[model samples]
Target: MSELKQTFNSSLGKKLIMALTGLFLCVFLIVHLGGNLLLFKHDNGYSFNMYANFLTHFPPIEVIAYILYLCIIVHAIYAYILTTNNRHARPVDYAVHTKSPVSFSSKNMGLLGSILLVFIVIHMGDFWYKYKFTHSVGYKEYRTNLLTNQTTVTDFTPQTADFEHSQSFDGDTEIIRVKDLHSRIVASFSIWWYVLIYVISMVALSFHLVHGFQSAFHTFGWVHRKYKPIYEFIGTWLFAVIIPLGFAAMPIVYFIQSLNK
Candidate 1:
């Protein structure tokens, strides 16, 4: 048991754990992005809220969320350990300037990761914590009249509202419903500073993903010299699209909704 513990505490083991958990978090990010994209498809206001409601009711999914939380903690701890170890290993800072073929992101992953960690804290506090621990005032019970394709907010609980009267709309058949989801998200980012923070955090996330994605694969020994190009391409793509689109979309969506109003 002591030997096992020691092995787990080794640098290689720590890196491996970080790689696995980082990959897990990446998968989580993808799923989260997919779900958030549903917000854009306001077929009726209920589509997104209904999905959100469903998520609240899903026991299996809740379990997965808990596991994800654990993975996040483990990843964070491993990251700190790695950072401290690296710092200790390099007691002297190199004063000379050197340029390598590796991307700038690859060299500054620790800084990027720190920024991402701060973003995660704010993100959890703003959305996840509120959703889980507190009731949202923006949620209104609605009933959707399927025959007339009309939605009206009724007197029932938001979670219990039927298909009809459940949707909200901004225009005629445009389905620009001002939902609780929208309001909460919009309200959070409405502050200019929050928006700025979100943008900077997204930039950090982009850089972090730029390096972390392929680094994880390399840590796992899944790639070789021939596959390096493919790995790099996919890593860059993930950074180029996933990070910016996922985080940036929130502000942009809110801004568009504001302009429409």
Candidate 2:
């Protein structure tokens, strides 16, 4: 038991965990990006929102999403531990370190990582919590725009004289509100500062992956003269394409919306 614990606690075991989780997250990002890109298609909001609604409510999918969230948390904890250990080991910061022909993103991995961590927190709080906890059957009111430039009425009214209760509104008619998902997303990216921050965070993510993707493989003792190049090439290409496309889509959507308006 002690031997098993020791082996798992070793650096090699942690690296393998990180590499596998990181690869899983990479696939998740692709699927997430594909879903979000639908926001740019104005005619697609009903479909997109319906899709999001289905994913959130579907039992099997919700189970998988929860597991994905757990993976993210575990990955973050492991990364924090690994980084802190590395930092403690290298007690002195070099004043004049030169880049060794590495990409800028590879060189500034720590900075990139920190930015991505912040972005993830904000992203989750804004979307995940709202969708998961707030929109219950009778707990909270959903304020949606039923008409252009007009706020919709409250929909939760009691039946006639069932309104003897303190919280009942017997005279009001039930309102079915409509939501514009794309507009809300575009509004978020419309602010100049948000656009700047979004772009910077994406750049940071790209840089973080530049080193992180292939480095994970090496950390797990996958180092060899022959296969290292293959991993490097594939990792770099995937990072280059995925992060930029995913992040840039929001800004482009906003830009096009601006022109149309």
Candidate 3:
């Protein structure tokens, strides 16, 4: 048991933990971006609200949400530890430090991570914390007619403040009520400074993931030469490009829509 503990307390163990947690968070980013894409629908946020409602109220998803939060904290902490230790171990740089083509992100992971951490706090505080703990987010009632396959949304007022979400059927129509997190999103994205910050953070995210994703695989000893190219391609294009652009597009589109309104 002491030997096992010592392994995890050592440097390699720290890197392994970071690898596992980082990959988990990467999967989460894909899922999260997929869900957030519903924000692009023009249905007055019916689909988006339903998605938000399911995530917060569903038992299994709630458990995963907590796990995701813990992983983020652990990943950040371990990253800071490794970064500081490396810096102290070599306090002076070599006059001719050889740089890898991908070393820009490798060297700046701390700065990129710090930016992403700030963005996550601001984002969760605006949406997650308010939706769960505060009444800052209003309510919406979405009534979908089964016959017509259409949904109409209206403002909802709960009889009790404790109410979070509800679902029911009235004849051929489904009545769903949930916190109006969609409106909160629109309100947030409408602001120019917020959009700027979101975009900048996504750029940082792209750089961070491009390096980190590939490194995570290498850390796990999966560095087969035949599959190295596949890992690099997926890491560079998916997490580093598509995911960040997908997230960045939401705010830009929403802000543009707000300008027209």
Q: What are the TM-scores, per candidate, against the unseen true structure?
A: 0.83, 0.74, 0.94
The candidate with the higher TM-score, 2 or 3, is: 3
lDDT of 1: 0.73
lDDT of 1 by residue, 221-246 (tens): 87888988897897788665665767
RMSD of each: 5.0, 7.3, 1.8
Candidate 3 accuracy as lDDT:
0.93
Worst 10 residues of 2 by lDDT: 161-170
TM-score of the candidate numbered 1?
0.83
Model 2 CA deviation exceeding 4 Å by range: 1-3, 92-96, 135-180, 223-230
Q: What TM-score does candidate 2 reach?
A: 0.74
User: Model 3, range 1-261, lDDT digits (tens) per residue?
Assistant: 999889988999999999999999999999999999899888898888878888987999999999999999999999899988988999778888565765788889899999999999999998999989998789999999999988888999999997888999999999999888899999999999999999999999999999999999999899999999999999999999999999999999999999999
Sorted on lDDT, highest at the top, how do the candidates line up? 3, 1, 2
Best by lDDT: 3
Return the lDDT, model 3, position 82: 91
